[model samples]
Target: MKSTKLIYMILPYTRRELPGWGKLFENLGGYKSELWKDAPIRTIRGKFHQYLMTLDLSSWHERMTYFLGRYYELDIQKFMIEAVKPGDSFIDVGANLGMITLMAARCVTPTGTVHSFEPNPLVFKRLQANVSNNELQQVTLHNCGLAEGESELTLTVVNEELGMGTFTKIPQQDESLISNQYQLTVYRGDDILPEELPGITFIKIDVEGFEPLVIRGLDRTIQRLHPVILTEVVPEHLERGGFSVKELCEIMQNYGYQPLNISTKRSGLRHHLQLTKLTDNQMTENVLWLHPENNLSSRLEKYFKES
Candidate 1:
């Protein structure tokens, strides 16, 4: 298992040096094979720890690759593991399959708590199964979604891509591909979490295009806790949701948070972290937002220096 993990980590970087081998591997059924057809539940080690993941090969091939460490987002996962402490409280919005949620659960164990929210009934079931299989007692799962207000909203689930579920209010071009639609309850974060959570340190948001609504709901929570946030920033998706990338960034800026580009470049056996101004285009899927007053930057610096 460890050897396989090392190969998955090194193969991507090695492929850059030997470009011709890509074709050779493709000819050997490497990319277009039914590798995970029979495997529904696979246990793989993440960058920080090992956990079980429920797989849906039908619509989640990319996510299955992530679980296998073949094409995982190691840098983002590493940052999350380093940012959370043992007693910290973390919130995972759009916790599909509990990947980051499980990582955060491991980081803040015994005394800490991880609150994960997933709206899609099918995906929530998988997320629940993963959490239960791992026996993460510190993790709490919610079946409803969060938005600026409390109301019923239409959630459209795409047949081929379950992860692409979005609010029907959002104007998505792929409406014809929707397989099912369900009315789900949406709540404001402040309303659900009335009291200040203990030791709140980190929050992750990745709700396809409804990020603005999610942030709107967490306005008071951000003002009070000021946790380090990691959120997806897809321009097209935001526009579909009736907002722009600039609008999202400005909203975070209002809460005293600055957007920084989180990138990873390989250097020998290490993946070096690069924090710079957000200059990348919409292709950069995720960005880290940190409050000016927080010590997260210094803490990350210390972690990388020692590593």
Candidate 2:
């Protein structure tokens, strides 16, 4: 089976009565439903085979919100077309539903590898399903969460709807929420260092508010691999976790990284911040960092050219 053809099987099994299935089909067969009209789809093609998968595309308003956020939302298809080397390794720390994992797998085709870690059970199930459905041969999925220490930790559900969880100390006032909360297994990066794992060239961390903890665990690994790390650092979340944005920047700088000023309007590089400004009460959603003295400007120039 060709790699491209696997996308057609990248589907979620459904028990829910879809509009075009069973009894519902009889009533809507001739109708023009918006759901079907705007169904998300992706096409994959290899040398001689092609396949299509139906993705759960976001609404226009949701997309607008994503655009409003200064985050690097790469073009997955184009990324697959370029950038990924044959033997590179990519790690996705906060892989939600394996969207970026799938994209990473597609880009790192042939012999590259992708390590995806997701802790939320609901999202983890979906991620596993997507990885299997796509028949991604080079992707490895892990269920354990990463943090500063290796131990069993109680994670409070911050947003039940989005399945976001936090491992920070929950307020004593929120004991009721903690009672029914789920506890997850976690491993420190020092316990499983970069030398132990395969070579890692890229890492994406988006553990809502847990970035500092994750980095603390990976201090040695970062010094060793020095992979291009993309992390989201929300100030409020950091403060709640006992850190601040300035401190986080200092931590990254201590590890030899310079903060990259990501643009809020477009997918282009801006002037890198020589020194990031932050207040004791300042809050920003996301930021990107690159290794100091790294020729990131030239790299981005080359990447945008080839990509």
Candidate 3:
């Protein structure tokens, strides 16, 4: 058995249901990650494909996927599979380690194209490695980020997983906490994407608190393509970046888009997500927005258990 598995064996299978207990078990096993800080890379087979990742218990993304063989968010994973069809063009903003990008590659097939953007150079390297290891030819990766316009900006990466990155003017944290900053270039999706990669049908934006800027950058493309967008909408993250949930909702509404909250069940072996229309008062962390004119929801009605 792999060393990582030995530590993960005690971790809860139903992570969402038993987070506290899971952590207790992990602590009992000394899997607080000091144990395998230098462990060898392991082969982990996921729902979509296998990954050659350096498995670690410390990284939340890895820990959940290590146990489940997929991303922690079951609904978003299911939606990506259902929403993106073969020969469709999909974009992954803030692609992280290319977990979603890898899955999208499988869905799109060789005929389709998947464009992934990652600003953190280290994470981008892993993203490139994963895509190459999987030998997905349809994917085109950019080492920079997309934004309202072309400009140089600072990227703040706050964890080992490199998923919690932000371009926001963040508040002052403790001096002891570790953060790495890098200068990155940003481009407007309108000025470049349409001419290079036309016919984009789907986009997933998880750019920490910079979600609003990304949407603004791709405003023209969204108008033209009316692609299905899966964007993160955490209120705290938005506030850190000087954005608000109300502003995000208004922006989408003005663009003729409606929202459905994306989340997973509390506990389940089979991970299938049902989409329901979100009300104005609902607090949404992740929202899947689509234009009524495009009528995209009509085609994917099986997934919606609207209440």
Candidate 4:
């Protein structure tokens, strides 16, 4: 009964998606999956996308979307929409439930293609469903992950968050935190991708702590295509993949790329989450690597003006 009033706030946002949450009145003392949540919901954050998300309200990725129209990285969406275009092959190395995949699919249309890779069987099902429901024929889903080379790795998923699965095992004091383990197939970027997919326009790779290996696997492919790469770059996460932040940047810089400070966090009550740049010292998580030779300035000139 504590959230009686709060239920009203969630009701307006989640009414139809909830299949009638007014049933909350029926069971004031308890909460059940059947009473409020249902299978396959139209995500508020997606473009009317039908997603088979978990009923767990504690998951930030799933929960935040209930309150705000969009959660997750706002800048990532902004960058993808602006950078991607029709008739361009966009690659998502670690597509979880096809958020960016769906965005790229709409951006590319049927003329182009989207190659999305998600190795987790549970998460792949959700990602596959989103693509199928939207009839995104241009998207070719791959139930695998990118690594340094062709091999099988044990993926660990915890706390029912499918997006959090990773090949790099986390050292934990309590093993009970590990909810599940899956043997997943992985490969090098150049080996798996068809030669026909030349000149990839953009790639967004976020494979938890295995980002460095994924980047290494794409060494040849990136050198050849020089696509704009949006990647997660946590220092500790890179260490898990046997790399430092400096080493990762060196690898990218060797391929003629430089990082750009795209967006930063701002105070909530005082201001909206406006599109702004973060100082180099502040940018520690995600980095957008631009290729000077191949990247079209026109694509981002509207958002980023030259000094």
Best by TM-score: 3
Clashing pairs in 4: none
Highest-scoring model, lDDT: 3
Could you list the CA RMSD of all candidates, in the order they appear? 5.2, 10.6, 3.6, 6.0
What value of lDDT does candidate 3 attain over all alpha carbons? 0.76
- What residue pairs are clashing in model 2? none
What TM-score against the true fold does each predicted structure earn?
Answer: 0.82, 0.65, 0.86, 0.79
Runs with alpha carbons beyond 4 Å of true place in candidate 3: 1-31, 34-36, 50-58, 196-200, 265-268
lDDT on C-alpha atoms for all candidate structures: 0.72, 0.57, 0.76, 0.69
Candidate 1: C-alpha lDDT: 0.72
* lDDT over C-alpha atoms for residue 164 of model 1: 67
Give the per-residue Cα lDDT of candidate 2 at 160.
30
Off by over 4 Å in 4: 1-58, 198-200, 264-282, 305-307
What lDDT would candidate 2 get against the real structure? 0.57
lDDT per residue, candidate 4, 1-307, as tens digits?
3543355456453434344343552344124333333323334435223332332344545544553344346677766666677888889988987777877887777888889999999889988877887778889999999998999899888666668887886767635778899987899988877666633478889987787788889877787777888889887777766677778777777787877756634353221222333334444577888888875555676565332
TM-score of 4: 0.79
Task: Compose the digit string of candidate 3's lDDT tens values, residues 1-307.
Answer: 3555565555344333344545654554444566556645555757554544444545655765766566667677778776777888889998988888888888888888998999889888989888888788999998888899999999887655577778887677622343688988899877766444433488899987888899999987887788898998888888888889999889888898889986555444454667888965784778899888765676688777765
